[model samples]
Target: MLDIVKQWAWYDWVMLFIRLISCFSITATTIQMEDYLTLPLWVVVFWEIIVFSVPWICLMLSYRYYLIAEMLLFGGLSLYLTSMFPEAYLTLLTPAFLIAANSAEKSYRWSAPITIVFLPLLIVLFSREIDVFEIFPQIGLAYVLGFAFHLLIVNHRQNEIIRKQNSVLEQYLTQIERVTLLEERDRLSKDLHDTMGHSYVSIIMGLETLRPDVASQEGTEKLDSLLQLARKGMKEVRGYLHQMGSPQDTLPLVHSLRQLGEEFQTHAKVNVRFRAIGEEYPVGKQVKMTLFRCLQESLTNAVRHGQATDIVVSLYFEPQQTRLEVQDNGHGMENWKDGFGITTMKERAAHLQGRVSVYSERGEGTIITCFVPRLVESADEIIRLFIVDDHSFIRESLRTILEGQRDLRVVGMAEDGAQAVELCEELEPDLVLMDLEMPNMDGIAATKRIKEKWPGIRVLVLSTFQDTEKAKEIMRSGADGYLLKSIESRELAETIRLVHRGGTMIAQDLLHKMLDAQSANEQEELLDAPNISEKDENSYGLTKREREILQMLSQGMRYKTIASKLYLSDGTVRNYASALYDKLGVRNRDEALQKGKKEGLL
Candidate 1:
């Protein structure tokens, strides 16, 4: 009862006021008409008070107690009052229909039959005072109409709740986003500080090491090296800015890969080639980003440690998958070792439900290949849609529009959350357009249950409310998308199609709000996650020599150099490296290197 009052909005208050006024008007008319039973005036007043005040007080009680009070008052006292004075009919609308609607909304399956049974008794008792046939239809019509009005008011109040919640969420998201951006900028500034400090220290040390031989070739060469270090430090600052300023979408995928190859070629002073096989196909944004990062990391490893003079990056497209391979004509090791880079590549590939493999030999080049699955459109398959909303008009509108498309079909519909679950379980529709507010259950709870039972069934929230918190809650509940009722028909269709193809769709305005909220949350989680300790080789499932080999490789040491340092034959070193690769679950040096850095092994 308290929760209901707390959730109440302006529409509820207005309805309450209107109901009170109408009840008062009917009582006044009864008093003016001087219509009374043979009972005394005080007795009449007692019954009238019981009829009006009891139901009002009942609202404050729990549902079970309230129903008991309502039944005793309305089924007994209300019926008697109406039987004696039919004029009570006008006043009964407020409390009687209100209770009935409340029961229908709160306990639809449990209370409905009882209410239906008692309703006829009330009408039959009223027949003694008035023409039963003449008034029955009128009273029934009024009850139905009142129930409809209650549903509308309830929906309006729900929208009010959503608006209030969204307001709070939007403010929080904006503030968090601001804080996150400031922190990121601070981190970048700190990195720049460290770089500049190191460069300045190097310059100072070179100056201090110089003697009166400042005019000598060695002194001149030292000054030149200092100048070069300063220039390189400045270039590092520019690189950070370029990365921060340019969004990934600004560069086409192929163009970006080519540019990545070209930049590495310029820096590493190696011949690098980029190639694409088969037609360029559509891939998800996350998949594209992963591939790009993998390529960048691979090139860095090839030139930095592979001793490669020539490199090749290739992208191959198939009907249902995209494959990327990076090959380097470098003096490869006798056996492949897993490093931080290689582990990182594998992790990135796994994000797209993909896998990575590596091929290398003692002197021959190394090739790293990653395969990622892509969603493919099939001409023969039809996209099934399920509509779940309390409003018939909304459901009908969606069903009509969706059914008109040849590739899309409305497989089922439900009026509320409980029905939606049952229908979805039986029909197993591909997509569900669910409304947030309903009679028995709500969209959030239903979405969670549906996803848990049938994870393949994608749920898209179709709500009149655009609450950011509610949107996040629904997404957390495993909904694929969220949309507002104000969406145009064409945009709605496109969004459905996108979601059906394993893409997420959020209303543009809500999308921006959610992005702000999610960005802050993601950054916070990223910062909060535990980092791998460099010395904890056992914790990371690595042997001592494996850790040592990884550290040396990170320093750009070759296999022979590492073997000499460790006082082991090159072949023995290779065996230990291969064992590390298996332990790390990585195929190549680049992935291993990436994984090592991620796990703090380097």
Candidate 2:
């Protein structure tokens, strides 16, 4: 009841009043004059109800701007009816015209007063027995007062309806604002997971990968300091998980650079140092963090590609902006291919509305600098994660594990191979745990296909199939590994470590497969699947994507089903099949299938 009233609009009240008045007056009119079938109440009732009800209904519909037609219609109807009804039935016109004209309460004020003054003249004209001036004026004045009072009450009711509508609008606006905030939080969290969260993880990983003894004593202290910073980052992530908003602070840029210098010195055989050139002040936390990431990414590049003996870190701060530089003395940039670390560094710099520079000489060194603009960083980011598995328990379990990792969060869950593939592609998980034998794209097939497209990705096939055939098939298909799905919690960590180690894991089973193969070599290996050449594509005059479609069509997947698999529209899929059929000199799915099979296109 409250919800309905809350949704009711200003016009609804006037319409309701008009309806009530109309209902009463019409019923009274029916009693007064026995004209039921001939009377034109349909137009009046429909107009009144719609004019009142539609406005309220519009209020209920979000994103619907106000429509002006209802008002114009009601006003036009009132004017027409007023002109015609005055001559035919004055009593009915009095109420009907008043209710219809009641659309504009403001107009009633002026029109009602004028009509009051003119009423005496009207009565004199209409009545024969009534006195021309004295009695008519008295009756007109009484009618005017009563009509004005009714109009005033109706106008007041309109205002109350408006007030109530405003109250509801306020609540709705608040809900919308909250939803917006949550959505914003979700967006920021995704940014962090892919950006800042990954940043910190790399920082910690770099720090841990470093050996303390490999660096100088001073460098050791600096590396220790970096570890402490990582711990501080963990705390911040924890505070967010606890829903506690904290004052975000940036560690000194010098501290982060020094830490990186020592870490690089230990991790790689590089002599690295931090040097400050200009005057420094407390730059904003966001700026400092951006600078830190800049240094970390630069160092990662240097270690990964440049076999350097020394690297220099410099900072120059001014009123408008700050400059961060990491120069490496390494094999240099001439032959250095594109790396993720460099891309991330450049991307992060751009995200900060800043510019990054990379200058390198073949023999001298690679120099990287970033200029950061001023932007206040959001303190809280809500992470969203999605996990896919055949079991709900596995999804929940993975969620628990991921959530346990500081700064790692999960947003959604999915069950089964198909859903897993869907969510993996949709969420683009940092890691995908593939389970072997489930409906819709078996683990082996999904892993191979996903890796073929995205090679740098990490996928660990968690399967109960301990068979060497499974292992051989999986790895050959470019899967990261085939692990016993029921790996103990203790063993899981090591397996993950192997996975993220940037290579496939060769367990005892895999080793046995390798050794057995070495002992009894088979020429036609189970691992090697026949690859279709461009010669085959040209022979068939169909692309691999087209061939795959033709094969599915041969297997009898409807256009809709094909569209779902290929992530294309049904029309697009039909067009592809149509083209394929045309190419094969055949019409329809079956002929295409038979031709495809004959040509080995399938």
Q: Could you tell me how far off, in angstroms, the CA of residue 93 lies in candidate 1 after the best superposition? A: 99
lDDT to native, each model: 0.68, 0.55
Which residue pairs of candidate 2 clash? 271-309, 384-411, 385-410, 385-411, 385-412
lDDT (Cα, tens digit) per residue for candidate 1, span 1-602:
67558656675576567546755665565566555655565565566566556666666565566666665665564465566666555444454466555554456454444444455456566656656565555555555765677688778767754654454345334534643564455445444544564355456455556645589787788777776776676677657644653254456678767876776666555678999988886565446656876887677667555766689899998777889899998777776766877876765564344667888887797888888776544569799999999867668878888777767889889999999999887888999999998999999999988977976787889886568999888876778778877554655776676677655656645765775786687557545645535345444556456778988888888876775566433434555566567677778788889888887677
* TM-score of each prediction: 0.37, 0.28
Q: After superposition, how far is residue 437 of candidate 2 from its true place, in Å?
A: 27
* Predicted candidate 1, C-alpha RMSD: 33.1
- TM-score result, candidate 2: 0.28
Backbone clashes under 3 angstroms, per model = 18, 5
Highest lDDT among the candidates is held by which one? 1
lDDT of 2 at 491: 41
